[model samples]
Each structure stands twice: as structure tokens, then as C-alpha cells.
Target chain A: MDRKLKEAIASKLMLLATVFSSLLIFAVVIGLIQKSRPILATHSLSELLLSSSWFPLRGEFGFYPFIIGTIWVTVLAMLFSLPLCLLTSIYLAEYAPAKIRAFIKPLIDLLAGIPSVVYGLWGILIVVPLIKDYVAPFFGYSATGYCLLAGGIVLAIMVFPIIIAVSEEVFRAVPHEIREVSLALGATKWQTVKHVALRAALPGVIAAIVLGFSRAFGETMAVMMVVGNVARVPSSVFEPAYPLTALIANNYGEMMSVPLYDSALLLSALILLLVILFFSIAARIVLLRIERRVM
Target chain B: MDRRKIEEDFFKGLMILSTAIIVGILFAIVAVVVLKGAPALSLSMLTQTPKGGYYLGKGGGILNAIIGSLYLAFGATALSLIIALPVAFYLREYASERFANFVRLSLDILWGVPSIVYGAFGFIIMLYFGLRACLLGGIIALTLLILPIMTRAMDEVMRMVAFELREASYGLGSTKLEVVSKVISRQTLPGMLTAVLLAFGRGIGDAASILFTAGYTDYIPHSLFDPVASLPLAVFFQLGTPFPEVQERAYASAVVLLVIILLTSVSSRLLTKRWSRFVIK
Candidate 1:
């Protein structure tokens, strides 16, 4: 009887796990349906997203600028961050002494755990003032640096750890024998790193950089704080801009215009979701091909 | 050779310089926050209620907020573990066939779904079920939020306990439950704790979800039904007005949040280090 009871309990537990997994998929399906429901009403969903004016309250809802803004800030952030992160990762992975690497690594990891709100606080108090007073006007730009320039700069800082940590993992994964052979052939440390180590880890590094791009693309809190939350094409690199994540965060609270507002917000979210899924899948496919070739 | 040497030196210098810049951003953020947050720090500000003014001490103690954040996070973590641990153990120890693999892949997609979107889902659905603006609602929301992580981490840990170990325990007449409770959980205690700590940290930092459900208040929570203040809410609510004093408290609270994160990270590092050493034998 005890053995039978045990088996019954075990089976029940497994069923519950199955149910929880099903529930999560159910959630994604609901969110997708909410987003895609607008297709029933509109012939041209592209225009809904592509129109520049986003007056959802007046019923002319266009999420174009927000999408553009998100892409702009993210592209700018990647432009600023990628090269810097690559060089830094190479330094830590190839050049840093054991003691220093151990010491500095956690500090970077600590940055990962620090809440987005704290970064927002820093952006407001320090970044905004510096921008308002100095940066924007200096470049014959708007009255603030709380634009693409400031937001991208801060985002690069925020995502720097991810780039370094992931790229370092990839760099470490490169077979030592390849580096060994290169060194034995009298290739210098830099040459072996440049030609062999980095080459071997290039796909993984691409994965890391792409993930960083997606993060910058989807970031909300700090960008909301530093970008002055303006919805205009940047007058200059120093001029303020809005992004899709910031739009969702900033506007979700007071959007009471029924289906129109909900439809617009959900559509943008769906687009952002698609963007993330695309990059993630692309990275996996690319890495799989690379891994096969290496094997 | 000379040109190559020059190029190498320049590249190395740039790498070191950029890394310094990255580290500098961390320092600069901390310094700026402390500079703004310090003058506002006082006994009453730490412990009093808000009045007016854009600068100096003006608000109530952040004590309630701190306490609320702690209880909610703890409650949420407990809920997540309760829901996730049994499920994980069942999945790993008993389940068979392609269905299990399919379920696992779905869990991965759930992991990628944004936290804000989850918040949106919870706000609408949880409210419909009468779980509205209460700590219980917040706790439930956070449980769902952290469940995927807890289960995935725990599942991996349980599976890493070798078949031979379980066999040896069975040879000594231990049942499956005994093997799980005594052997697996004990062996994987550090990994389990790390996962819990990570979930706790995420819960503490979370704001978007709570902004919709766990409505903010200044008063201390007298019952689970009472709406409560948390660090994230404190920061979010203060952003509306132009009061410098309230805003500065937001910075101090931000500092406190960072401290909580730092402490959790440090503790987890220590725990994992000790566990790896324990496993080396």
C-alpha cells in the first residue's frame, strides 16, 4: 500500500510540472493574439506601424517614430559599445594577469546585478545636467545632451559587462592546442590571439555582440531617464529621442483609449518581440553552422 | 616590425583605456548618487513622512519600504521554490518521452518573455480573480515571474546527482523520497541557494510588475491586505513631482537597492566557492 501511494504521488507531481509548462506557453499565445487582433479591423497594418504621428488619444495611432527611435538608439549604442567591448574582452581574456582578472571580474559582475532604477538615478542627476549645460549646445545641437549621445553612452556602459563576460567565455573556449601550435611557430602573443584565438571564438563573440544589440534595442529604464523622453527624429546626435521600450514603460499607465491604444501598444510589443526572436534564432543558426565546421 | 610594434602598442593602450572607461562609469554613478543622496540623509528622512520642499530632509522613514520589499521578496521566493522544486524533481526523476523535451523548450521561451509583459498579464488576470493591490497578489506575480528560473536550475542540479549515488542509497534501503530529501537536496544545496538568491535579487529590483498591482503607500503594512511601499516604487513615485528632497531620497533608496544587490552577489560568490571546494573531493 505504501509503495502504491508513493507511485501515485510521483505521477501527480509529474503531471503538475506538465501543467506549469503548458500554462507558460498559453501566456505567450494570449499575448500574441492580443497583438495580432488588429488584423481583423485594418487592411494595412504596416501603415499603423509606419505612420509618424502617434496621437493615439485622437485615434491616429502610429508607432513608427518609437520603432525608429528604438532602432536609432540601439544602433548608436551598439556602434559605441561593440568595438570597445571587443577590445576590452580581448584585453581581459588575452592580456590581463590572473590576480587582476580575478579582482576586476566581480566588479563587472556586480554591475550586472545593480538595478536599472539606480542607473536611471545616475542618468538623471549626473548625465542630464552635464548634457543640458555642455554637450547639446556645444555641437550646435539642442539644449540637452540627454539625446542619442547620452543614452547610447550610458547603455554602452550598462551592457559592457555582458559583452565582456560572454566574449571572455567564448575566448576561453578556444582550444589551447591551436594557440599552442601558433606560439610554438614563434607567433607572438598578440598574433596568436588575433589570428587563432579570436578567429576560433568569432562566432561566439558574434553571438555575444548580437545579444548586446538586442539588449540596447529593448532597454527601457535608463533610456527613459537620459533620453529626455522626446519623440522626435534627433536634430543632432546630441538631441533627445524616444524608444519603443521607453514608450511602453512611459505610456502604459495612462492609456485609456480602449482598443486603439491597446492595439498600438501591443503591436509595438509584438514587433519588439519579433526582433528579439529573430536575432536570438539567427545567432543560434550561425553558431551551429560554425560549430559544425569546426568539428 | 617597427610599424607592427607601434600598432600593437596603440591597440593595447586603447583596450586598457576603454576598460578603464567602463569601470569609471560604475564609479562615477556611485559617486554622483552619494553626493546627491548624502545631504538628504537624516534620522527623520530615514524614518519620517514626506511634507514639501525640493531639497533637505522631507519624507518619512524608508523603513517601511525596506521591510515591505524584504517580506514580498521572501514570500515570493518561498512560493517560487514550492511550485518549482517539486515540479523540477518530477520532471528530471520520472518523466519520459518527447513530451518532456517539448515542455522543456517551451520553458526556455517563457524565460525570454519580457518581465513587463508578464506584469501586464498579471495585472489584468490576477485582478479578475480578486488578487488586486495586495502583497499576496505581488507575491503570486513574482512566483510566476521567478518559476522558470528556479525549476530549470534545480532540474539541472538534481540530474547531476549521479545514478550510482542513488543506487548506493537504494542499496542501503533508502526510498526515492529519502534519496531526494537527504542526498540530492543536500548535495545541491549551494546550487539551489544560488538560484534562490538570484530570484530574490530579481524580485527586489522588479518595479514594472508591482507598479500595476502592488499599489504604493506611505504607511507601514499592518496586514497582508494593506498596500505597501517598496524601494522600486519609492523611486518610481518620486519621479513625477519636482521636489528635490523627495527626489534625493529616491537616490538614497537607489543606493540601498545597489547595496542589497552587492550583498547578494558577494554572498552567492562565497557560497558557490565553498560548494565547488566541497565537490572537489
Candidate 2:
């Protein structure tokens, strides 16, 4: 091939590749929409979104319980993890020695890289048994080893590393001079961290938490193993309940046997996709604000 | 005691305690997996396939899953590299800032989209083609899952390539493609390799995305059309069984997966350090 022609062809091919990569998001959205159209056409949105009964065999496909379950589990997890993660991030950013920070940071990243399934397995063997043996009894609930509380606890552990990693970055982004100035004003290290660094990093920390929330909400294999895959509105954290991710993960294969079952599963997936997209965009906006401030 | 001193001591103690808890949990997870799975980790488990009633607590191994996971991760990583490299190159070398940012935002959203959604998307694609759960479906799903991670990581590395080098290459009459292949890629090779390894780790460890798309079986796949087992699925299915022995095997499978991930993570860290020695900045 001519040299100029070859370069032109290569440039054109790269552009084509970029265009293809960018279209993946649209492709997923379109695929979900097309696949879920059957359910959308057959069922009312309110019924799908509000009703709690989820009997797919009888053609009842209410996702209300799963939504509630997702919210309940995710909220519980955040409630448990947020304070600890913040404290850990604060320590890593301000309190720990450089060597400690170096060692701990990668340890946290290692925790993050551990497979979700391993977390699920640990949840089954450890968290479930603990709940069944102790925590459930204290709450006057009989634990079957798989319940919302187990799922929430497992999820809390799973998201802890993410929250700590991001929030630590946010805390670190507060210029060193700001800390020095606060310390020079006779404020203790804790006081400076609380009054100055925390305030400045608030937006980024919230973005990190939001990102963690989306991560917990979309997590599947871990939650599926622990959150008793029963589709119902739980009366207590110790009760078996189904979250959206668990629902789709557990049922998509079997749904092919029934009418609109596949659609219902796809609809759940679509809902998850939209929820994640919203949080991701929100996180990016907050991160952009942080970047502007830092720069 | 001074008020500020007391308050500082209390908060510092709390922070230390929290960090302890986090580190403690990491140790606990590894300890429990090793304690339970060590007995079941055998050479035969690494070499043989499942026998009759393996899920029912009979003798067998997870060789099928090990091989299948390798096949899927390798295939998916190769596919993702083919597309992600070009896209990363385009973003760094050609695209407008606005266009690049928009593409990055889209990639971020795709990165956060739940793995289950990918499975569902892959399942839909399979249905449209009247295809069953097979290695190909799994690879396609995993490719999508790793695409953003690999591209963004590569883009970050490529951006770190000194602009002066590119200018110098152009001054020598190098085409844009030549500069990208020879100059930019050479500078970013270590980071790119780390990204690929990271993506491969993710692809191999993920279960939800491949749950239905891969359709787990006990045998090693003979072709792209064949259904394949994976370590995660093996662990998931075995752990779900009522048999105690099978559950032990599940733990063993998890140990295998954990080891693979840790190895990848460690190697990536080493690669970054080693290759970083060659980077100009």
C-alpha cells in the first residue's frame, strides 16, 4: 500500500474503533429497551413498580419488594460502613505514618480486588453462622443463615475498601498548606482534620459514598448468596428478602420458560443499569468540582 | 486533662480502632478461607474433571473450571485489547477535549453498570441469535465488562507519554500511526500490561456477569460453542449443595480463585515498578 494511503486507512480504522467503543453504552440501553418491551407493553408501570407480589409463573411481576429490599440492604450497609470508612480515610490521610499508609492502602486495594464470590463464600461460612448463632437471637429473630442483615453486613465489608480508597483521595487532595495553617492556629491534628479538611473534602467524600452506594446496590454474587433470594418485603433485617441484582442473577435462566418472565428480568436489569448510570454521572460531576477546586 | 487533648485522644483512638477493624476483617477473610480450604486443595483437584455425583459429595476436581476460566479471561482480554487500544490511542492523539471527556463519562457509566446487567444484555444477544449459553457468549459479556477499565487505564498511561517525544517523532517524518505504535505504545507498555492483567483478574473472578451467559457445566469446553464451567460458578454451585464434602470443595475452589487474583495483583504491582524504571516521567 502507498505510505499516505496506509496512514489514512489506519487513522480511519482508529476512528471507527473509537466510534464503536463509544456506542457500547447506547447498545446496552437499546438492547435492554428492546428486550423489556414485551413487559412494558403488557403491564402497567405502576403495577410493575409498586406491587409486591412477584409470582412470575402466574404472570404477576411486581418489583416493589425487590426495590425495597435493595434500598433496605444498601442503606443498612452504608449506615454500617460510612462512619468506619470515614474514620479510616481520615487516619490514612492525616494520622498514619507514611509507611503505614503505604502498607494499608495496598491492603485495602487487595481487599477490593478479592472476588465478590469469595465474599459470598465468606458470608455464607462466617457472617451467616454468626448471625444465626448470636445476632439473630439477640434481636428475637430466628436466622436461617441467609437474611437481609447478613447481606447488609457482607455488603458493608465489601464496600468498605472502595469508600476508604476514594475518600482518602479526597482528604489527601486538601492542600498541605491548609493543614499547616490550621495547625499553626493552635488547632490539634484532629481539630484541623475535622474543621478544615473534612469541610473542604465534603463534596468528594459524598461522591465517594454515592459511588459506594451504587456499588452496593448493584453487587450480585455476594448479596445473592446471603440475601435469602425470597421476593418479599421483609419485616426485619433478619428476614429473607430479595434485592434487584439477586433477583435477576437468580431468575434470568429460569425465566426463559415463562411468558414475559424474560422481560421482567430484563426490566430489573434495566432499572439497575439506569440507577448505576445516575450515580456514576453524579459522582463524575462531584469529582469534576473537586478537580476544579484543587486545580 | 485539657478539653482539646481529651477530645483529640478520643477521636484518634476511634480512628485507630476503625483502621484496625478494617485490617482485621481482611485477615479474617483470608484466614477462614485458608483454614477451611487447605485440606481440599490437592494436585488431583487441579488436574482432573468432576466425576459422577461430584456435586453430591463424590470424588472429582475443578480442572474444567480452571481451564475454562483461563480460556474466557484470555479470550475476553484479547478482544478488549483489540478495541480498547485503538480507542485509547484515538482519545489521546486525535479526539477533541470535549469529545474525549464525553467518551470518558460514558465509559465511567459503563464501568459502574452492574455486572448482572451485562449478563442480561449478553443473554438478550444470545436469544436474538438463538444461541445457547456458551464460551463465546461469556467472552462477549466479559469483553464488555473489561472494555472501559482497560481503555481508561491505557488512556491514562498514554497521556503520560511526553509530548516532546511525539513532536520529535513527527519531526522525523513519522506518521501518526507510526508514532502511536512505536513511540507512545513503547512508553506506555508497562501500564498497558498492568491494565490488561487487572482486567483479566476481574474477568476471571466475576460470576454474576457470566452466571447465565456462560451456563456452567462440569466438563471442559471443546469449542467456542460449548458451555464452560468457571471457578466462581463452581464455588457458587458447590457451596449451595447440601453435602458437606461438596461445600469443602467450594472453599477449595475459592482458594484457587483468591490465589489467582492475588498473584495478578502482585504481578501488576511489580510490573508497574519495574517498567516505571524505563518511563521518562
lDDT of 2 by residue, A1-295 (tens): 5877978998888889888888899999999999889999999999999998888989999999999999999999999999999999999999999999998999999898889999999998899999999999997878797998999999999999989998999999888998999999999998999999998898889888987898899999999999898887999989998999998888776897999998999999999888888778777777788768856
Compared with the true structure, model 1 gives a TM-score of 0.89
Whole-model lDDT for model 1 versus the true structure?
0.73
Model 2 per-residue lDDT tens digits across residues B124-146: 89888998999999999999999
The candidate that wins on lDDT is 2
Q: Write model 1 residue lDDT over A59-148, tens digit each, in one string.
A: 676677787778778887888888888988888888888887887788787777777677777877777778778876676655655777
Interface RMSD of each: 2.8, 1.2
Q: After superposition, how far is residue B44 of candidate 1 from its true place, in Å?
A: 3.0
Task: List DockQ, one per candidate, in order.
Answer: 0.46, 0.79
Clashing pairs in 2: none
lDDT of each: 0.73, 0.91
